[model samples]
Target: MRAASKKRGIEVTSISRPIKPSDFHDFDLILAMDRQNYEDILNSFERWRRKEPLPDSAPNKVKLMCSYCKHHTESEVPDPYYGGPQGFEKVSSMMY
Candidate 1:
């Protein structure tokens, strides 16, 4: 996917380490794959917000990854772990 994105003139960032609040300043967006992570992101941001209040432009930057996902329109992605591949595939079909 990274290769494909590059071929199409898109930039791909892959995170291989723990994310810290300071990292947000370098990226245009920070999308959490699910709500749990979203809350984690929010909580961390809040900690930063206490020190540096976010500008009005901030809210538009932080978002759940599902918000941009073509598949899950309901604001949350279903857990596919217990449901197996079929569940994950369902989401894949909707997305692609």
Candidate 2:
């Protein structure tokens, strides 16, 4: 992930981990890059909520990150894995 960010001139010094159920309780907001990711995160939280007690407001915590971006042209941010460097740079700029 750091390498990907570096390619787009974004500094990423922190390491990342697999998403966990506890993330729903840890972060105030959880954002996903795309619809698939949005659903996946929600599903994980749903599974956790099924086994544990969560606040009634917990279901509203997860959302699409792009929904917060005003300048982005697309509703879903494109995954740059199969695209060129420009795609990565575009996503980086949109993020900034």
Candidate 3:
């Protein structure tokens, strides 16, 4: 991922972390790369909701990342970890 970003003149300095319930409050939008991820986030939100009250818009904040794509018809950002270099490039292109 870092290599792909560097190739595009983007600096990747942030460490990866799991989504937290608090993120719903912190970010205006939370994009999921794929269906599994999208479902996972919604499921997580449900679990958190049982513990406390969440914003009514919390569920709406989660979305599929590729839904914003203008040039590509992809529905989700593919996981590049197993596809090697080409996979990363494909994801980078979709994001761009």
What lDDT would each prediction earn against the true structure?
0.63, 0.78, 0.90
Pairwise lDDT winner, candidates 1 and 3: 3
Better of 1 and 3 by TM-score: 3
Model 1 residue 14 CA deviation in Å:
5.7
Using TM-score as the measure, the top candidate is 3
| CA deviation > 4 Å runs, candidate 3 | none
List TM-score per model, in order.
0.55, 0.79, 0.93
Summarize candidate 3's per-residue lDDT along 1-96 as a digit string, tens digits. 888978988888998799998898999999899999999999999999999888978999999998889979989888899899999988887776
TM-score of predicted structure 1: 0.55
Cα lDDT for residue 70, candidate 1: 67
Model 3 residue 44 CA deviation (Å) reads 0.7
Backbone clash total, candidate 1:
0
**Each prediction's RMSD to truth:** 5.4, 2.4, 1.0
| Worst 10-residue lDDT window, candidate 2 | 1-10
Candidate 1 off by > 4 Å? 1-18, 48-59
